[model samples]
Target: MLKNVVAVVLEEVHPFELGVACEIFGLDRSDDGLPVYDFALASARPGPLRTHAGFSVDVPYGAERIAEADLVIAAATGIQDGFPAPLIEALRAAVERGARVLSICSGTFLLGAAGLLDGRRCTTHWRHSERLAARFPLTTVEPDVLYVDEDPVITAAGTAAGIDACLHLVRKVQGPEVARGIARRMVVAPHRDGGQAQFVARPLPAEDGDSLGGLLEWLRHHLDQELTVDQLAARAHMSPRTFARRFQQETGTTPHRWLTGQRVLLAQRLLEGTGEPVDAVAARCGFGNAATLRHHFGRWLGTTPQAYRRAFGGVGQPAGR
Candidate 1:
């Protein structure tokens, strides 16, 4: 249903965020049997648009192009405080007509300006989350999540998360086969749940001296094994209390929480790349059983293992492979 797509740009747009939309929707992949969107770039004020990266892009279409789009993406721009009235109206019209709108990073500000985010759950980059919330008091800004999909408006956090939001839209509308095919071509993960946390600007303080990095790597390799705080602490050569404190300081989450997150990520990869049974995938990811895996999957990804595989399983792999 999302056949036509348009990226609405404003001056001083971030090239990478705009490129995210273009890469996912604008590229011609018909040779792969993937849908080729009727994609175009439109500017709120047509002509040469400056990018934050010191370059300018010549967008040929004007705001009117958005009217014909099935999906409208507002690319991140430096100028978010005020949006052109025509652009805002076009966005409102597009949404009113049942077209979905997406915002990458700071682009949520424009949606806020358009009053589209009012009383809706949305998010922007963690760095700008507070400002967005402050400016749009009516909207609920969830700062930690990578993205938020509230029907007509999908807002993604900084940079790469835009890919997650875009692929999610594809998966929801076209099915996982198309999304996975595009993701395979893009060489990126097809689906990172919107609930995943944004990596903080300072993930680990430099003073930590990379002491836990090796341990973390070891834990990843041993995810199938039953791990506990004591074992992890022993592996890190610290008291359990010290390890717990240090882990939180460095990772912004507890050891158990981080391990569970890693396991969930492993389960996701297994589900997408293989035709393994739900129980096998669960065991491989340390969930012990299919029921347990299902519980975690529902809590973390808002979907079941079977459903996820059906949506994103490898193209040629057997259902029971």
Candidate 2:
């Protein structure tokens, strides 16, 4: 049912967050057998736009484009004269017309300014979470989540989390199959649950690179095999305690939590891409059985494996969150 998407590019916009919308909705991947959404970049004024990086962009469309959009995404733009009035009105109008709205990073502040976030649960960059909550007393701010989907309103934390939000929109609008297809082309994980913590504190040191990257790849490929914390430590050639500590430092989560997320992601793919029964998908994803898969899938995706399959297996089926 989603036919058009309007990305509201503001002055001082973060190119990466805007690029996330373009990557998911604007790209012409129809040649690869994915649905093509009508995506447009619009601004409050139709003219040269400035990026936060000190570059200029020419956007041809204006607020009028938001009128026709099925969805509107507000990309991060550096704070300007306390948010322009036209942008606020345009955003308010879009939501009033029943268009789904999404905000990335500081973009949520724009939503808050428009009074749209008054009674909603939303999230933004972790550093700004406290200020967002303090500024908008009516809004409940969740600091750690990568994104929050309060029905028609979605908000994402930071820049890369924009990808997770956009893919989730695809999953909600089309299905997991379409989302996975797009994600496959982009070479990123398709469905990281929005509820998962952003895991930001343990910043990877610049020189070390990601020590667990290789281990993660191996673990994903061998999901069917039993993987334990101690075994994973041995694979990393470190003591069990040391590996556990480092894993948390690097991934912002314990190994067990990370492994659970990977298993759930695999189960989601299997449910969407294969007609195999739930038990088979479970076994293949290392969930042991359908019941185990159901428990984890329900816990992670807020739906049963069968329901997810039914939704993403084909068109005209209801897409589950």
Candidate 3:
């Protein structure tokens, strides 16, 4: 049902995001037995629009073009400037008529300006997450996730997350087979759950004379061992209850959840970098058995270990090869 699509291009549109929309919805994939969208670009007043990369693209359709679209994309653009009033109203009207509207990265600001994000949960790139939250106080922002899908108004983070969001929409509407075909053609992942965390750059957990920090590094190196809160509490020289509270305050997550996240992250690396069997990887990560590892990996990543290896780790290659 997601056939007609239009990208609303504003001045200083980010080319990578505009390209993301064009790549997923604009390209013809009918030869691969995939549905081809009738895609075009539109602006508030149809004319030449400059890109952030110091180039120009002539947009031929006006805001009225949005009336015929089943999906409208507010591609990433300059967020500091005011949006055209007519364009904002067109976006609202499209949403009112049951058409889905999506924004990529800083394009979320446009949705915030249009009042489309006032009551919904949304997200943008982590770099802009705080600004988006500060400017749009009504919406709850989940800064770490790749995308937030609140029906009819999805918002994606960076450019990669934008592709994930589009493929998600495709899979939701047209089925997984079609989504996989499109991804194969693009040579990207067939799917990445919208709830997956963005690969945010974080400082290493250094043990610079910090008690909890030292414990974190130790846990990383000893992931093969079964660690409980009581043992960890004793190691830190605190009662279990006090340790739980302090750990939560320090990491923003429960001890168990943090350990699981860490284990899953290690599993991801092993799956990507080595040809170890699932059972071996499970033992190495202290998952006890392959079944337990599969259960937790699927719960955390929305995919099986074998499937992840197929996508990331070279199939059948030896370790360190």
Candidate 4:
């Protein structure tokens, strides 16, 4: 149903954020059996737009194009003094006509300017979250999460989080198979929960020895093993408290939460790509049983394992916040 998409470009747009919109929506992927969107870029005054990266993009469409879109994207432009009035009106009108709008990074500020974020929960990049909240007091700003899908309007944290948000909308409307196919072609993770914290790693001193990269990889391969904080601490040659602190510093999340996320990700791959039974997949991912898998899967993906399997077979909806 989300066939048309328009990414609204403003002065000083971040090319990477704009590219995220283009990569997910503009590119033709019909050869891969994925849907091809009627995607284009629109601006207040269509022409060569300067990017914050010191480059220029020749956007060929104007604000009028937003009216035809089922979804509108506000790519990152940081905090700007003012927005184009006509473009803001178009964004409001598009959403009022039942279309959804997504803002990546500081682009959420544009949505705030248009009054779209009012009375809704939203987020931007953590670096800009405080400013967004202070500037838009009417909206509840969640600073740490990757995104907030208040639908009709979704706000994502910076960078890779945009991919997660867009793919979620794809799975929600076009089914998991389409989302999976597109993600495969993109060579990216197909699903990341919106509630996952934004990663802000702080590496230990070089003398503290190579971070936990190797240990993290080991855990991923041996996810089925019932490991505990104390056991992991022993493996890392540190006290339980020291391990927990270092894990939080390096991963931006507690060890338990990071392990759970990895297991859920593994479960998603098994459910969609393999014919393994629910219990088998659960055990392989450390959930231990179908009920536990269902519980975690439902909490993480907002869909049951059976529903996910069926969705990959061409039905069901998946989303989370």
Which stretches of model 4 miss by more than 4 angstroms?
Answer: 203-209, 314-321
Model 2: lDDT equals 0.85
Tell me the alpha-carbon RMSD of every candidate.
3.1, 3.3, 8.5, 3.5
Per-prediction TM-score: 0.85, 0.87, 0.67, 0.89
**Candidate closest to the true structure, highest TM-score:** 4
Give the least accurate 10-residue stretch of model 1, judged by summed lDDT.
199-208
Put down candidate 1 lDDT per residue, 203-317, tens digits, no spaces: 7656747558888888889899999899888888899999998887777678988888889989978888887888888999998999999898898878888877777677875
- Error (Å) of candidate 2 at residue 189 is 3.4
lDDT of 4 by residue, 131-213 (tens): 88889999999998988899889999998999999998998888777888889989998888788778656745346565887
Query: Model 3 Cα RMSD, Å?
Result: 8.5
Write down the TM-score for model 4: 0.89
lDDT of each: 0.88, 0.85, 0.86, 0.89
Question: RMSD in Å for candidate 1, one decimal?
Answer: 3.1
- Cα lDDT tens digits, model 3, 255-280, are 89888887887887788768888888
Report the backbone clash tally of model 4: 0
Greater-TM-score candidate between 1 and 4: 4
TM for candidate 3 is 0.67
